[model samples]
Target chain A: MSLLRKGQQWGTFACVWHIFDATWQDPFRSAHLIKKYLMGLYKPIYHPLNQCGDHVIVINSKEIALRGDQWQKRVYFHHTGYHGGATWTLAWELHSKDPTMIMKKAIYSAMDGTLQRRFTMQRLHIFPDDNVPKEILENVSNQIKQLRPVPNRLHEIPQEERDKIPRLIQYPSDYQLK
Target chain B: MAALYRVLNYLGKNVVLTAQNRNISLSAVTRIKEIIQKKEGNTLTFEAVIKPDPYEGRFLKPKNGACAICSSGLDIKHTDVLILSQFVTSEGNILPRRITGLCETQQKRISSLILMAQYAGLMLRRSPKGGLLHPLQKRKWKKFNSYYDEKTIKARYK
Candidate 1:
């Protein structure tokens, strides 16, 4: 495997490609992580406009998880440039309408505005699902892991396996655990 | 014969001409159109002029050059149409080249620019539309807004 600096920049001239998979992860947190990488914060030679950022590919955005009541509290507003064209939609509604919007917005907002900011943003790629085209996928040199692992669902645990666990304590005769 | 002569005298010049041209059979008023044209000559009407086509049976070809932004020398990053809106749909998928009407090179450029914008939080990736609520989510905030008489939420954050 080549070193980060060598692989990212070909003799200090070319940009590197960095692909990521974000399936079943919180979009807010993942976006933050992506923004850091985008600015080359991790590199010692990081600068504002040297074009040091690597290309990032994100997949399975549809499975993004939102913590707590953010879905209800968050709202996006827009206008149609006409009389009474103002519209407001809840976070969840927008997610259903476009699965990849949140992550893209989060990443876009996190980066600082600079001369290279626009060029940097173009390196980021996001998909709602894992249906990326083969031509694009071929350029992926590495994968950025999710910040947190998604917890397994209750249904995913088999009934026979659940029954095998030992009981910690017995309930009182008059008290009902149910 | 005497009655016919009286009728001809009443009809005057037209009758006299008809009688003179009896061998030719019908009067000018009731004569066949072809016979009338043959007699009057075909000089009254103009013939259709046939001109050569400029395009030679071919339609105007579509431009297969660089996209509007690239051709105009305006960077894709500065253009919201390519970065924040036009290139991507509300559902967060990249619009196809056919719909965007961009040439292959420009389409590729815009696609990269969009990804860059997304990475920088200049454009949205995930849907702004949130998921379904459990009816109890953010209940306190909702009630607080109602009690405070804050009906319009426009420009609240701005």
Candidate 2:
């Protein structure tokens, strides 16, 4: 029941601008959760084309949550064209080697081929520690500026976002059709 | 009629060249002449301008470097603005024609140029920072990893 509650809460997450240092959760699992939250797949108004997602930064990657006897049972395998060059490593070993890589790979996998997916994956700035650089926070808005929250039908802007000058859209001049 | 069409076409291209760069649209003029020839039962005499395009003199200066975008514009003035404006994005997508406001003719040329740059590895193919994820990530709960789905599995297995 507790697990279900946490999962439910995670499903409707608002954009939290904080560092992820809560626990030693498996970044692999946490990355998927992060991807789901930021990709709009879990949102009420999820549209495949609509730009809807939040910027997520996972800091202190060295510590993330994990479950099961995955450290032993889980083995990552990769191949090299040369025979007998196949490489394998356990999750426990990889986590220590580079915790940042694990989450980076997982979140990357979740995003897939969407423009928003690209934005989400790209927006995910990871650091080994809890402190985010000042430059990153400043540049966040420019990163996700293209993805519109809602489709502009009349191309009207709400009172808040009207400060940015958008290209004026107009109906064809009366002389055009004639 | 064919001659008149060629004359009018050359006149038009020359006018554009005169104002901008030395790009005389030699190909366009050739195309117009060819088009006129293709017309059956042609009644007009054809005339090709033997004189050099006037725009070339203003835009292209052998003593002074010519503007790549406009040969006719003095000192190739607009090249810097044009080149900077057309810089490719990190992900390989060439900026599209609409926002750039380039005419169809110039747009086509720019597209070809961008493609060459990308192919030569001088430019990146505007791709997202992280690559696409295979479908198996979402479907991991199902215990099978795959790029294909049920429809594909059914087709292949059957």
In model 2 chain B, the worst 10-residue window by lDDT is: B141-150
Query: Per-candidate TM vs. native?
Result: 0.47, 0.33
lDDT of 2 by residue, B84-147 (tens): 2233433345555544444454455556555433322223343346542222232211211101
Model 1 chain B: ten consecutive residues of lowest lDDT: B143-152
Decoy 2 TM-score against native: 0.33
For candidate 1 chain A, which ten residues in a row score worst on lDDT?
A169-178
The residue ranges of model 1 lying beyond 4 angstroms of the native Cα positions read: A1-14, A173-178, B1-158
User: Which predicted model would earn the best TM-score?
Assistant: 1
Tens-digit per-residue lDDT, A102-161, candidate 2: 668777875677556666676567876677788666544322211111112111335344
Enumerate the candidates' DockQ scores in order.
0.00, 0.04
Native A-B contact fraction in model 1: 0.00
Give the DockQ-based CAPRI class for model 2.
incorrect
